[model samples]
Target: MKKFQVVVKCSLGIHARPAAQIAQACSNLRAAVTLETDHETAQGNNVLEILNLHAAKGATVTVTVDGPDEEEAAQKIQAVFEAMGPKEKKVPVLKVAFFGTKDYDRLY
Candidate 1:
């Protein structure tokens, strides 16, 4: 058995997309895994179960994995959580200081 804890940092928290990714990974590994919030524990191999956990931003959860490939599965599970964390927007923030300056900044 292996265990790892991750605190969610996604902007909108843990939603269906990330949950589904976790569930698919767990199912592919054929490992028994569970995701636990403060008071609820849900099977990691099921998308609905993970989504139901309702882990919001800054929430911490522990992932437990038990199987022949427990270590590998645990690592994958941790990666899944890490991948779900909030990422910067692809479009760069353009700042145009045209109020006092004559030249406007170029847009990306």
Candidate 2:
């Protein structure tokens, strides 16, 4: 078994997007991963379980991976959390714009 701690960085916490991403990543690994925060433990590969954690920004979360690939799984899960946004930093929503090109009319 392997365990590591990560801080939540998303502005909205582990909401749908982050939760889904984490779940998918964990699901790809062979280890049994779980996340612990605020005295609550959640299955890392379950979107709903992770979402139920309600881990807000700056909150420290502990992830545990157990099985044959525990070490690699821990590292991968840690990387995912680290690349989420920023440690202890909140992400701001940005507006995006789409530009039309010469082929736009053809597609329309």
Q: What overall lDDT goes with each candidate model?
A: 0.85, 0.86
* Tens-digit lDDT string for candidate 1 (1-108): 888799998878779899888888888886799899998899988888888889999999998888899988988888888898767779879886534433443332
Worst 10 residues of 2 by lDDT: 99-108
- Top-TM-score candidate index: 1
Task: List TM-score per model, in order.
Answer: 0.79, 0.75
lDDT of 2 by residue, 1-108 (tens): 787789998777888988998998899888899899977889988999898898999899988888999878887787778778845657899998666677965575
Off by over 4 Å in 1: 90-108
Mark the 10 consecutive residues where model 1 has the least summed lDDT.
99-108
Model 1 TM-score, all chains together:
0.79
Candidate 2 to native Cα RMSD, angstroms: 8.9
